[model samples]
Target: MKKIERGMAFASRHVDIFKCPVCGEGFEEVMNGSFSCSKGHQFDFSKKGTLYFLRHGVKSDYDDIKMWEARRFVLKAGLFQPIIDEILSLIPEKNYLRIVDVGCGEGSTLKYVEEQRTNREDAYVGFDISKKAINLATRDEGSAFFCIADLAQLPFASKSFDVILDMFSPSAYGEFDRILKSKGLLFKVIPNANYLIELRHMLYEENDPQYSYSNDKVLTLFKRHYPHAKIKKITYEFPLSKTFFESLVYMTPLHWGAAAEKIDAALAKGLNKITIDVLLLIVENN
Candidate 1:
C-alpha cells in the first residue's frame, strides 16, 4: 500500500525491549525508532505518535476519499452520536487515561468520543493502516494524534493504555493485549446481520442478503483471547437522511462491488431515510 501524506512529526516512544504482540517473542532491532522482532516481522513507526502493525495491507476497496467524505456526512448528521455517547457512558471518568482507536477512518468516532469524555488524561491515539484515512483523521480531528500503522503489531509496550476503542474496525487480539494495561477496557462497535439492509437488499439484486455476522462470534473471539474479559453488548437504530444515504454507501465496504451504472441507479433512487443498527461491545482488556 502507498503512503499518501506527510504528517507533522510528533514525539514518539522508542520501541526497544518488548515482545511481539502477535507472537510471543523478543525485539532484536530498533531501526528508525521501530522495533523489529527476530522473526523478520517489522512494524512502521509514526512521526505523529504510534505504529502501523497490521499484517494485512489496507483493503483496496476502502482506500478512497469519497467513502470517507460520505461517512463524515453521515456521522455529522448525528446518526451515530448517541452510540458514541453510550460508549462514553460506560467508560469511567478519569484524569490520566491513555486511549487508542484502531482503524480510525477519517477520525469521526474518535472526535466524537473526545468531545464526550468528561476529562482526559495523557494521550489520545488513533491509528490505521491506510495513510489516506490517518491523514484525513488528523486533519479533521486535531485533538487526537494520528498514525498510519498496522494494529496487529502495535509499537507500544505491553500494558500501556487505559481504553481501546474499535468501532467498525478490524481487530488484532494479541496486539490489543500487549498495549492495553491490565484492567483496561476495550469498546468495540460492530454491525448486526441486518446492519444496512436497504443498501444490501438493493445491491445484492436477487440473492438473499449475505450480511452474515454474529455478536456471539465477537464475544467468542474476545473470550478466546481474554478469558477474564467481561462483555456487554449495546444495540440501537437511528434514522438516516438522504445525505446520510450517500455517506453510508461510501463509508462502508458493503457496496464496493456494485457496478458504477448500478450505483448511479441507486443514487438516482435517493433515499429519504435509512436505518442503522450499531452493536457495541465493551470488554475488559485482561
Candidate 2:
C-alpha cells in the first residue's frame, strides 16, 4: 500500500473525533483515503499521510520548513525531557484515553510524552497549522495521528478528547472546552517572562523594555475560563551544549523577529545554557 493510504488507514481508527469544519457535520472516513462530510465537503489525506483541515492558506510564521526542521533536531536532543517528565506525571493512570495535542510542532513533545506511556490503549493525535510541521510529525506514523488543522475552528466533534494539550500554542478556550469531554483535562503550558531569559536578553538590549512580558492578562483570561484551574510554575535552567545551540536558537521563535546581524552577533557570543520557565495549568473541562 502507498504511504498516504496507510496513513489514512491508521487515522480511520479515530474518525469519530472529527467533524466538518465547514458544515459541522460528522465525517465518514472513506477507506480510499478521504474524509467526506454529509454536505459533500471532501478532504484528502496528503501523500505523506497527513490530513489537512486548514481551509485558509498557511499564514503562520511556524509554516517555515527550517523552523520545523530545527525543532525536530533540538527536540531529539531531549532538551524538553524535564517538561515531558512533568507532563507524564500529571497524566491520569487510565487504561484507555484520547490525547490531542494542539499546535503540536513536529509532534516532538507529544511523541515523547506518548513514548513514556506503557498503556497500549491510549490514542495520541496531534494537529498543527503548519503543513511542514505535520509532514515532519508523520515520520512516526503509527505512534500518533498528525494533521494540519486550525486551532480556532477545530474540526473535531464536541467532547471528543480526554486530554487536550495546549503547549506553547494558541488557545481557543471556548472551542477547546467544547471538544473536551466533561471529565477531560486541559494541560496548557505557557511561557513565563523568564522563559528564554538569556535569548531575550541577546535579542534585545539589557535595558530594552520589550525584553520582558506580562502573563498577568493571560492568567486572568485562563482563570476566567477555568475557575478551578491548578497552576504549576515550572522554572529551571537546562544546559545547552554547543552541538544543540544552533538548533536551539533556530527552533524557537523567540529571536526570529530580530535582525540577522543581531542574531548572528548573539550567536557569536555563545550560549552555555538557557532557562525553561513556563506555567503548566491543569484544568478541568467542566
Worst 10 residues of 2 by lDDT: 2-11
**Candidate 1 lDDT score relative to the true structure:** 0.67
Tens-place lDDT digits, model 2, residues 1-286:
6668766766677778889999999987665668787788988888887788878887778888887888898887877777778877887887678989999989888888777886557888899888888888878735677888888899999988999988888899989989999878899988889988888888877576657877888888999988899989898887787657777788888767777887898788869988989999998766
- My TM-score estimates for the predictions, one after another, are 0.77, 0.94
Predicted candidate 1 versus true structure: per-residue lDDT over 45-145, tens digit per residue: 56443455555656766678888778777786787777787878878777767777887888888887777764564467777777777766755634566
Candidate 2 TM-score to native: 0.94
Model 1 spans > 4 angstroms off:
1-59, 206-219, 226-233
> What does the lDDT come to for candidate 2?
0.83
lDDT of 2 at 203: 82
Each candidate's clash count: 6, 0
Residue 130's C-alpha lDDT in candidate 1? Answer: 74
